[model samples]
Target: MIVSLHSYIAFLALAVVLLAFINALNGFLTGREFQQKRDRSISLAGVAFFHLQFLIGVIVYFVSAKGFYALSEVGIGNLSSEARLLALEHPTTNLIAVALVTIGWSRHKKASSDKAKFKSVALFYGIGLVLILSRIPWSQWV
Candidate 1:
């Protein structure tokens, strides 16, 4: 059940991250004034989604048979590629990715100008998204 919730949350988290990244990229490229309230809200929403997803994923990792149990059964040194991806890479990489998103949102607030704010989101969130996409176990999830 927790795994299922984590899986479902992945879709929403990815969507909001993409939306926030693209929106910031557009604003940065076009030199648009970042609407203080709206822009921050969008970034915050994305950050919130990522934070929630990461926590749920951590919970699922401990509970799911495919997660910690598989890791324990095979041991880290003996894990197969699929098991390694699920038990190690996915969780580790996703955690870092979410951290990046959170940092980006926090840093954007400290930025002095609209361009800086947009750039902060574009760079951090964009890289974070790529990391997330790379680490997801597509074969299992799909």
Candidate 2:
């Protein structure tokens, strides 16, 4: 149940973050002012979804057989590349990715100008998106 929830939530989080990244990039390119209702909400939606994904992922990690159990069963050194990814790389990398997204959201609020805000979102969220994409268990996920 937890794993399924995590997986489904991950899709939502990824979509929302992608939208936010594109929106920020567009704003940066167009020199548009960040509106409180629309632009802010878009970014906030991304942050909210990513945070939810992280929480669900952590819960799943603790409970899923493929996560801590596999790590403990095989031990880190004994784990195959795929097992290591499930137990370590994906979780760790995604934690970092979420942190990057969070930082982007926080920094955007602190930015004095519109371009600065867009830049912050574009750089950090773009990087976060990349990291998230890289670590996803593509073969397993599908």
The top-ranked prediction according to lDDT is: 2
| Residue lDDT tens for model 1, 1-142 | 8888998999999999999999999999999999978888888889999999999988888899878999989899999898899999999999889889888998998999999999999999999999999999998788
Q: lDDT at 73 for candidate 1?
A: 91
Task: Give per-residue lDDT, candidate 1, residue 64.
Answer: 91
lDDT of each: 0.92, 0.93
Deviation in angstroms for 126 in model 1? 0.4
Which candidate's TM-score is highest?
A: 2
Clashes of each: 0, 0
TM-scores of all candidate predictions against the true structure: 0.97, 0.97
Number of clashing pairs, model 1? 0
- Candidate 2 stretches with Cα past 4 Å from truth are none
Q: Cα deviation in Å at residue 66, candidate 2?
A: 0.8
Worst 10 residues of 1 by lDDT: 36-45
RMSD value for candidate 1 = 0.9
TM-score of 2: 0.97
